[model samples]
Each structure stands twice: as structure tokens, then as C-alpha cells.
Target chain A: MDASLLTIQPASPEPIYRQIVEQLRRLIAGGQLGAGDLLPSVRDVAAFHAINPMTVSRAYGMAESEGLLERLRGKGMAVAATVRPTQTQTQRLALLEPQLQALVRHARELELPADAVLRRLGRLLED
Target chain B: MNAMLKDAADRPGPPLAARDLGHGYEGATVLRGIDLDIAAGSVLGLIGRNGAGKSTLLRALLGLLEPTTGETRVFGKPALAMDDGIRQRIAYVPQQPEALAWLTVAQMFDYLGRFYPRWNHAFARDTLARWQLPANKLFGKLSPGERQRVELVRALASEPELLVLDEPAAALDPVARRELLREIALRACEAGITVVFSTHIVSDLERVASDIAFLHQGRLLLHCPVDDTKERYARLWLPARLGPHAPASTLGRRSHADGSVSVVIERDAHGRWPDEAAQPGVRLDVLGLEDLFVEIAE
Candidate 1:
């Protein structure tokens, strides 16, 4: 996995640690981070993001608790070999839910028809 | 005093704390009623405008300066009379760290390392090499930024439980600043080092600080988690006529000649803005630390 895939928005209201957790979840579910792929050390991410290492540790801890990551002694964190097979499809698509919600909300706010919004999404997927 | 010591032994508290700490110079008050409790394993960023008493507060906390009122305690012992064991556990990097100009960097390290029980010479050597600081050069020959890095190396090598830094980044360039922050984070994460660093660079604070304390007019105007501060305080733009209806908690305000007003107000603890901010003409914008500082300082 590209360590650079993890990024943070300092201005956003979301806590830094949650951002790390959410982004790592997306990368893992999206297949960008495959099973057993090594996640960057907390020190590296915290240094790159200029955030508290505790925040990065918290994110890693949350992912570990959720079974998305596994800790290997002396090897740092890695994507778990298996994560939620029962909800595999749901979990993969769930990664896009927030962006989709925002798109739908924006379309509704602009008074666009639901069909029109769906058509645009279809076109986007095709692209 | 014996009773207090026994009580401290019974129930250990925060690594550092101060209660109603106040100090003055020549009868003119500089710090007043300052209160702080530094949690173990957390990074706290202290920020304020020039001469806002940040230095004084740090000095008082370290027991370097006697408070005219109230008191400061380190590991529950009176700060002023901290035993050598307690003193050894704490390290300080002053705003303008001074060194013996005649001594080579290696000699200086050797001198300081003698005093620290847990000093790691290898760590100090590695950091110097990483920063590309010349160990052979006399301390006086190094630039201000290099000097600062040396101080950092010395401080970090000690493995102190509590590290106090006053404007540690003032002399650092951007790259060096980032390196310093990374070292601080690594220490806090691995060793649970308790850090209290004051800086004018809000961006650095935004990055590493778990919590931020804003000193204004000789008092702590705000102290809270960085995330909470970001979520709760915002700048709102509205027509000048609506200014009177601004939230009662408006921290600062500025009137534009265009008949619009910009006001900084904090949302309630529930993270809800005042109804006035939700009115049709009001436009609320999230503020980064720098913007927030400007608004609050003004």
C-alpha cells in the first residue's frame, strides 16, 4: 500500500486519529491495501502528517479492535488476512457511502431529479 | 509539609500541575491566576502574542521563578524545592538556548550527558547525524537553528519524563521544525513523555498538540483539546447591522468598511452554534489555528 494514501485534513472538524482510521479503512476495503500489506509505522505517519503519534496509535488500535489490522511483534501493523467476510460486499461499498451521501444530498439541494442524479452516477462509474 | 508529602506518596497525580499560579515583576503583574494540569503522555502547545507571559508561566512551572501567589508542583512536590531525583526527571529547552561558545558540540554533549542517569549517547549521536549538525564545530560557530537542534538532541537524549520547551522552534527552519515535531511525537508515543512546549508557530501546534492553551492579557483564555477547539470556534461573516445579535460568547470582532462584520465565537460544548449564526445572512467558516490566533489576539 502506498503510505501516501493516508492523508489528513487539519481544518476539518474530524479528529486527526479518526481521519487516520477512516482513511486506512477505505484503503483496505478498496483493495489498495491487501491482506498482510504492511501499514506504515505510526511514527512515519505521525511525522508526515505532523500529528500526534498517539492519534495515529489510537487509529491503529481502533482498526486492530475492529479486526481490520493485526499487530506483528517487531513488524508493526499489517492488514488482517481476513476482515468481515460476512459483510464483504457491504463493507467494500460502505467505504463510498459518505461520498455518495454528499453527492445525493447536493443533487437534492440543487433540486435535480433522483433519476438525473442516478444517471450521472452511472456515467461516472462508466468513466 | 510532611502531611502533603505523605498524601502525594499515597496518591500520585499528574506529572506537573499549577494552581492559581501568579507572578509579577517589580509590582507589575505579568502572570495572574494561571492554572494548569499536564497529563502524562500528552503534548500541550502554549501560544500567545509577544510578552503574553508564556515565558513567565513556564519559568514558574519549572520552579525557576518564584510565584508571587499560588504554587506549582511537580510530581506533587513543591516545584521550588524539587529534589535532585525530581529535577533529573525534567528537562527544559529555553526560548533562546545558550551554550558554551568555546566548547565543541561533542564536548558539550559529553558535559551534559554526565548529569543524566538515562542519557543515551547513541541517540544523541544519531540525531546529530540525521540533522547534519557538525559535532566537531565549536558551539559558537553553529547557526541559531543548529544550536537549537543541539539543545533538542541534549534534551531528548536524557529521556526525561517531563520536558518543557519554551519557543523551541523559534530558530528552526521549516524542515527542521518538522523534524523537531516528529522527534517529539516519537518520544511521546514510545516513552509516554509529558511535553509542554510553547511556540508562536500555530501550524506546528496544530500538528502535534493534543491540547492547546491560549494565553491572552496575562490569563489563559482557552485550554482544550485541539479537535474541540477546531470544532467549537469559528469565524462568522454577517452584515454589520446584525452585529448586536452576535453570540454572547463572541471572542473577538472586526468591522469591515464594506458594512460587513467578522466575529469569532465558540459553539457550546454540544458543538452547536448560536441561532444567530444559522440566520439567513450569516456565513460561518471554520478557522485553522493561525486564523483563530489572529481573531483572538485582535
Candidate 2:
């Protein structure tokens, strides 16, 4: 992996390590990463993103514990071979659920109608 | 084994510890009573407003300056009496580089390298070349940014166990700042080096610092893990009608013209909000690190 594609918002209230864990989960579920794909080393990811390595290692550890990744001796982490990513379509949608809920909340706060929100969402999806 | 590494792990106490540390100059106090312990393998970000005595605290902590009250310990030994072995294990970079203005960059490095047996000359040479700093140019002739980078290079080349940097990226561009952060992270992760750096850049602190120390008016107000600030603190707004219900232990209490009260509140030990937070018409807003700083600092 280039590792550069994995980015984090330091200013976000969420912990940096949790951000990495969630991003990796999404990538794996979306098929950007698959079984047997080599993940970047903690050192490389930390150096590339200017983040603490412990944070990266913690993210990898969480993914490993959840069966998304497995450690190879002296080779760092890799996508777990046994991961069939069950319910991937739902998993991918689940990733966007928070943002979608946020958008609907904002629309409701603005007193926008449901049809207007659906039209806007449809336009954005088409784009 | 390196004495620094041995001292870090074998010692029963923190690598750097201060007890009621206070300092003054000409009857004017700079640091108030302070008690702190910097654990091994932790990156502590020291943050404060201007004239908050951050430098004085660091100087006192490292034994560069004698405190008017209390004491500091380095590796469980009195900081004021560190021997050559202890001295060799620590590296400090002051905010401004003025100690070796008379020597060229290369000469300065060469002179300093003699004092540190394990100095990595290759790192100094490669970093200087990569940073586009002239090896033969007088240290005084370099721009502030270049000077700071040279100091950083010198500090890292020493491979010390305890690295103290005072605003290490104050003069650098954004790109240089990022590069410096990466280097700091790499050192802490690979070598398990304990680091204490004071920085005005909160975002950089958020990214790499494991712990944060907030100094306000020479007093240490908050010292906690970086992530805790977000999940543990919030702003609670009380309507004027419920003004009497505001928590008394809150911080940064303010009364707006609308006759409402806003105060900074923290989760209890059991992770529950205050009783007033459950009242109707009360609003609670979670605070980010920067917002938390502003709320309390302002």
C-alpha cells in the first residue's frame, strides 16, 4: 500500500488511532484492500503521516483483534487471509451511516423538505 | 547497554520528576508550585501562552536553573547534581540558537560530537545536506529557520534518551514543521526515547504527543493524555432560570449578557455528567482540544 492514501484529520475530536482503524476497516470492506494484501509498517505509516507510531500500532492491533488483519513474522501486518468480509454491502453502508444521519439532521434543522433532500442526495450520488 | 536506556527502565521513578518546583528572579516569580512526573517512553507536549514560564519550568526540570523552592529529579537523582554520565544522556535545544554563533555549522557539529561518544555524524551530515544548510557557513549567518533546523539536527544526532525541545518548529515553514514532526515521531517509536517539547502548534501536538501539559500563568492547570481532553471535558450552558443549578467545581465560568451561565465541566470518575447536565433546557457541548484550550485559557 502507498500508505499516503490513509490520511487522518488531526483537528478532529476523534482519536488519531481510532481514525486509522476506521479508515482501514472501510478500505478493507470496499475492496480497496483484500486478503493477502500487505499493509504498511507502523513506522512507515507514522513517518508518512507525521503521527505517533504507537497510534498506528494500536490501530493495527485493533484490526488484528477483530480479524481484519494478521501479523506476519518479521513482515509486519497483512490483510487476514480468512476474512471473507461478510455483509460487505451493509458494512460499507454502515460506514457512511453516521455522515448520512448528520446530513439529514442538518437538513431538518434547516426546515428542508424530505423530497428536496432526496433530490440533492440523488444528484450528489450521480456526480 | 546505553546508560540512558538502562536509567530509563531500571529507575523506580519517572525520568524527569519535579516536586513543588518554584522559581523567581529579583523577587518576581516565574513558576508557581509545580508537581510533575514525565514517564519513560512518553512524548509530553508542553503548551502555554506567552510568558507562562514554560522555559523556566523546562530549565528547572533539567537542572539548567536552580529553583527558588522545591526540587527536580532526573533519573531519580537530584537534577542539580547530574554527573557527566547523566549529562551525556540528555539533549536540549533552546528556542533560539545562540551558544555557538562563532563557529561554522560543520565545525560546531564536530566540536559537539567530541562530547557525545555515540553521536551519529552520518545523520548530521545527511540532514544538513537534505535541509540545504551550508556546512561551512557560520551558525550566526543562517536564517532563523535554518538555525533551528541545525539545532534539531544536533539534538537528534546525539541520540540522547531524554530529548527536550523548546518550540522546535517555531521558525519552520509548514512543510518543514511536518518533516520535523515525522522525525520526532520516528525517534520516539523506534528508540523509545522520552521527549518533552513545547509547541504553539496544537495540531502537531494532537498528532504526535501522547500527553499534554497546559500551563496557565505559571500554573499547571491540566495534564492528561491528549485524547482525554476531547472525551472528558465539555461546555455546559445553563439558562438564567437555572443559574443557581450550575456546578460549583466547573472551570471558566462566565455569565453572558443574556443572563445565562457557561462553564467548562468534566465527566465524573464514573464517566457521568454533572447532575445539572440532566436538567431540561440545559445544553452540553463536547469540546475539542483547541476549543477546550480557548474556553479555559480565555
Off by over 4 Å in 2: A86-127, B1-13
Model 2, A29-51: lDDT tens digits are 87788898899999999999998
Best by TM-score: 2
Error of 2 at B33 (Å): 1.8
CA shift of A59, model 1, Å: 2.9
Per-candidate local distance difference test: 0.82, 0.86
What's model 2's lDDT at B120? Answer: 95
TM-score of predicted structure 1? 0.81
For candidate 1 chain B, the 10 contiguous residues with the lowest summed lDDT are B1-10
TM-score of chain A of 1: 0.70
Residue pairs clashing in model 2 are none
Per-residue lDDT tens digits for candidate 1, residues B1-298, read 3443453356366878999999999988999999999887789999999999999999999899999999999978899998887887789988666768899999998987898888899999998998789999999988887888888888889888899998988777778788888888877777777899999877788779888999987898888888777778888877777767776654788878987888887777677887777665567766777788888888
CAPRI tier for the interface of model 1: acceptable
